[model samples]
Target: MAAIIGHILPLALGVALSSVPIVVMVLILLSPRGRWSSLTYLIGAVIGLLGLTTLFSAIATLLPPAPPEAKSPLIGTIEMLIGVGLLVLAAIRWRRGRRHEHNPAAGTPKWMSKVSSLGPIPSLGLGFILMLRPKNLLFTLAAGVAIGATGATFAEAVVGIAVFVVLGISTIAAPIIFAVADPARMRRPLEGTREWIERNSSTVTTVVLLVLGTVVVGSGLAHY
Candidate 1:
């Protein structure tokens, strides 16, 4: 039992960290136009995270064995790619926000709005899709494989993934719940926080992704 627990802990931490992006998405969903019931968000996040894990598992099964020489460079490449992808995403979002500000009529697309309103389910679907992007998926898969190589059993991996999904959803829901439950007290603060996040999220997310990616890539390369 102790051995099993030990093996599981790292995998759980990896999964938990990976779920940060999803948590951010959930927070974005809690906006005035994006409000969703907490239950809806929870359900959506579970479905989405499960789908991502399943897809990753399927792809991993088909992958060629990692060559001894390839492991280090592969990890580094994956990390760098993830960082670049995040930078690109942030840039696009930032530009879009600017455009929206300049032209009130040029709001986010109808389809996107519809998806946001569908609560967590659609968001989960979207998050799964986002994860499937080549760069993102590569980083995520590499991370998973690295964890497995570190002695994580299949059960441990599953538990880790589950914890991550739950925690990610909770992060988003917690703020919304607090705001809604005590609107009179929280209204101003919540609004202020929301505004700050909206204004700074792209910059903050981009910086985080870049730093994390660089560190992961550097570590992987050094290991090689």
Candidate 2:
């Protein structure tokens, strides 16, 4: 389980470092309907991560058993594909970020502005969608495949998966924790962060995708 956690941590942290989702969740927490929306959004995000893990893990069982050498190549191939996709995504975002770096009219996603008006259920749904953004989905799917490659016992597997889900969602859930603990202190710092991310989300996304994609590619190639 520790090995699984160590192996998957970078991908999970890349997911946790996503700016748009964190920004959206922060906006929800600053809304008039802040408390409920924030909580539901966090809940929905957690559910999404766990749900994807479960789906991939189950799908993994459908494959016929193979020797360790044979199995690593197949799983590694999937990871490599995911890495290449992310690298391409990173390049696109990097160029886009550069293109818009000086455009005062450049705008963020439409949904970002809509978070404050959302009711609890819609907030939950939005939470789920935000967490499943393409980069995050691909990273989580890669982690899921890695988990499936483990030969841990069923009990150990469950524990490892739980660790992944918790760590993966930590940054997304950050505001919720401090909201319940100390909203006053958190608000100022978070608000500053929100504005910064709003302006630089594309760059943030690009950097994360580049680093995570490189690591995932290295991990995949190491399998051979």
Best by lDDT: 2
Tens digits of per-residue lDDT, candidate 1, 53-156, equal 55554454444445555454554554455445545654665675577677878643455445435555555456545445443453445444443333445776
Predicted model with the maximum TM-score: 2
* Candidate-wise lDDT, in order: 0.49, 0.80
**Could you tell me the lDDT of residue 159 within candidate 1?**
66
- Model 1 regions more than 4 Å off: 1-36, 61-139, 148-151, 177-186
Report the error of model 2 at residue 40, Å. Answer: 0.5
lDDT digits (tens) for residues 93-127 of candidate 2: 88888878767576776757888899899989988
Q: Give the CA lDDT, 0 to 100, for residue 43 in model 2.
A: 92
Q: Per-candidate TM vs. native?
A: 0.58, 0.92
